[model samples]
Target: MPRPIVLGVVGDSGAGKTTLTRGLIRVLGDEHVARLNADDYHRYDRRMRREMGITPLHPECNHLDILTQHLLHLRRGEPVLKPVYDHRDGTLRAPAYLRPARFLCVEGLLSFHTETLRSAHDVRVFLAPPEDLRRGWKVTRDCTRRQYTTDEVLRELDRREADAIAYIAPQRAYADLIVTFTASRTDDPSHLDADVLLRDSLEHPDLTPLLEVDHGGVALVRRGRDLLLRIPGDLTAAQVTGLEESVWDRMSFASHLRARRLGEFTVGTSLRRSNSLAIVQLIVLYHLVTARATVALGGDPVRSEWSAGVAPEPT
Candidate 1:
């Protein structure tokens, strides 16, 4: 078996990392993908963090060296006894034994903080929703799911802001792709626009032909050495189908994997779909399966013009 393809999805808390990862896992099949949340590596529990005046966003709050070792092991097709962090009550739980599958999806706050940690993955994606939007998301998720009161979540956000700037924001410079989802004109959560910055670090599917079509509001623009692809949320059914088919046509080799809908998300127990989200997920899916194919052929999965010497501008 080819070694498992590792994918790192790094973002600040409530930046839609889980939503994006969940969609990919659904398409990739849960059984074939080993999931790891980097939050499990927290060095201190919630109460300890409060007492120490430290936040999880800071590197010192995480067992990063151990996390790096486990990531390296997974890349080499090894099993790990991964730690579990219970978010509901903000406590550390017993470690869980995890075996590597065909792909490893690691999502968390600081997965890409160090070079060794970054190099363990075939794909690195960063979520960078607008500050206001992310705050709203955090409030909603923490209040409803994590048992955090609105006031507590807001206070925590304020406390973490400094560390977010110093530590979390800088990781965007290292990602192959930066994804931002913003509210549309009507402020509908389900119909948010997606702006994807495709960095030169990875070879992405060519979307130039789709740009020529007058399909709703989809666009691909070149920005310096990178490409920015925008997908509007309110696309017509026909337009959405055309764009999806164009990408699906290119990755026909992996056609058998498209058994479920791509952009299904929930807003307070109400399930919704977004054309923009679907398109973003499809593009990511393209890279993942493409990388898997390259690895199976005994070739390096990444083909890049990116250099460590060139520091990317913060997105």
Candidate 2:
């Protein structure tokens, strides 16, 4: 087996990092991968922040050395005890169990904040959304997770912008891929185009291998063109071949392959099939670990963290 690849995805808060990670986890399946979130490294709880009048967004407000230790353990293919962040309460809850897996993802605002953490990753991704878009996301995410009202979220965002520039903005230059959704123009874009770009980068192989497997006791909803021959468990060599065969038949353009593009075709996940109750207890591992359809507005692909401040301020 090939040595597992570690991908580090970083960005400012609410930059679609969670959404991208969740989508990939579903596509690749949990058994083959693991994710770590950097948010869990927050140095204080909401009460502590309030008492100290410190915002959680600042890099100085985190226990980064502990984060460094956990990541080093994962890279060595050993088990690790990771700190857990409570999204609802905005604090560290407890420790989490992290097992070794084939592919590991470390994601967060400051995953690449230091050179030591940067050296552990095989691939690096940075996502930065436009000020408005991030504000929009922050509003929605905070409301959902912490029951904060829109106005309150915006207030918090205003105060945090300086910290983002001083701390968060600089990390982008070190990333292999940088994805931003800041809309420069009035019209915004659906995120599908961005997903398409990211999917292209991963460049998954043609559906040949996935088409051969036999799906076990799949529900009626699981049948048809957009289905994958999901091997429910470990397979023997011959069983694996049979699995591949089934997947290929689905991927083949035998009038049944799902459409990938307008004219192009694909197999499986062509249509989103979300179960109301999600499959796993998704705890974003910190420490875990994009692209552009060029939204009509902010479509520039430049890695501008260094010059973001010095560049002429647009009116």
Candidate 3:
């Protein structure tokens, strides 16, 4: 069996981590992918945490040691009894049996919080959308799906802000890619622009050729230690189609993909396709596929060693 390529997607509460993870799973066949949520490792249930004055974002509130152990086991192609966290009511659920698949996609708040956990992934991604945008997303999601009132969501955000600043946001420095989505002039969330930080460590795909498209909305610029990939928000459907083609230009199996364009944005009862989401998923999917290829050629591509460091400020 080829070594499973583990991709870690880390971000704060409403940073679109699950949506991105699901999109990747859809693109890769689900049977070939195993999914995990880091939120499952919380040590205290919602009620307990509240009574103890601790937030889930804090390491003290989570079972990081167990999470680290599980990550190591998963990377070694071993099964684990992974814990479960029910977001709907913030309760701890029964553990689930997880068998390693061809690919592993783990998404949650603290996947990169420890060296042991970080060492288990072949790719690390951090989503850092603007604060306002993230706040809007959080409020909407909690109210609609998690059964919280808008005021309650706002209060929770206030409570988590300190922990987010101290713990969750710092993980961005360790990531190979940092993704941010911002509103366009019209302030439409669905049509938001994407600012992606492609760090120097990974072998990123070159999208330079596609920049010539009229109003391509894709630009690459060098700033200090990273390269930024900017996708404009106002691109037409045809323009987005062109960009999607460029993303898959190098893939020999593009035609056979289970879900080529499968990222969606949901607000209240409305669900619509999002070009920005699809592009982000595609870019990460490209890295996973390449890592798999490296393993096939027997080069030991998966990263099994990790070190701790302070994350640098966004450039």
Candidate 4:
């Protein structure tokens, strides 16, 4: 069997990393993908972090060396004794035995912090949601699920801002795709606009023709060697179908993997769908399946032009 294709999703807390990966996982089938949360490799628990006055966003706070080793192992189709971090109480639980599957999705704060770690992934995605939106998300999630008060989450965000700027934000330069979800004109949570920066590190499906449709919902712009794709929140179902069909037509080899829904997410307890989210998810799916095909043919899954440079600021 070809070794598993590794995807690295790096972002700050509450940047929609999990929400973005969840749809891909559903389409890929839970059993076919091995999941790794980099937070599990943290060097300290919550109490220890507070005592030391360090945030998890700081490189010194994570066991990144161990994470790189485990990522290498997984890429070679090997199993690992992965550490577990329980976010509910901010404690490290017993380690879990993880076996590599067809694909490995590693999501975390600093997955791309080092050269070796960045090299382990066939596809690298960075989530760069606007600060206000991310803070709102962090507050809601931490308060409701992680036992953190709103005030506590807000204070923690302020404390981590410096580290986020120094460590987390710089990793965007190493990503093949930079995804930013911003609030729509109406500021509706369910219908947020998506802006995707597609770097030349990977060969993305041609979306130039979609720009000619004049639906006023999707636009693609070129910036030097990269492309910026903008997807609006309120697209009609027919428009979405047409857009999805264009992408699906390019990846007929992976048609069997399209049974599950894309862009299905919950706001609090209510499930909602976003057309822009579906488009973003499908574009990502295209790359994953394309990489799988390339790997099966014994070819490298990523382009060789990838180099470290300043990543464009998110729009």
Candidate number that wins on lDDT, 1 or 2: 1
Candidate 1 regions with alpha-carbon error over 4 angstroms: 305-310
Which scores higher on lDDT, 2 or 3? Answer: 3
Using all chains and alpha carbons, the TM-scores for the candidates as numbered come to: 0.97, 0.61, 0.93, 0.97
Give the Cα error of residue 201 in candidate 3, in Å: 1.1
**Where in model 3 is the C-alpha error above 4 Å?**
212-215, 253-255, 302-314
Model with the higher TM-score, candidate 1 or 3: 1
Worst ten-residue run, lDDT, model 2?
275-284
Which structure among the candidates has the greatest TM-score? 1
Selected candidate, larger lDDT, 1 vs 3: 1
Ranking by lDDT: 1, 4, 3, 2
Instruction: Give candidate 4 misplaced runs (Cα > 4 Å).
Output: 308-315
Better of 2 and 3 by TM-score: 3
Model 1 clash tally? Answer: 0
At residue 120, give the lDDT of candidate 1.
86
lDDT of each: 0.90, 0.54, 0.83, 0.90
* Model 1 lDDT per residue over 189-299, tens place: 878988999998888888889978898978889998899998887888899999999999999999998788889899998998878888888988898899999899999
Give a tens-digit lDDT track for model 3, residues 1-315.
Answer: 876889999999998898788878877888999988889999999899889999999999988899888888888889999999999999999999999998999987898887678768889999999899899989888888898999989998999999999999888878989999898887776788888898866767787777676646578888775689898877788888887788788665545773455667666678777777778878898888888888778886533122334445655
Q: What alpha-carbon RMSD in Å does predicted model 4 have with respect to the real structure?
A: 1.7
Tell me the TM-score of model 1.
0.97
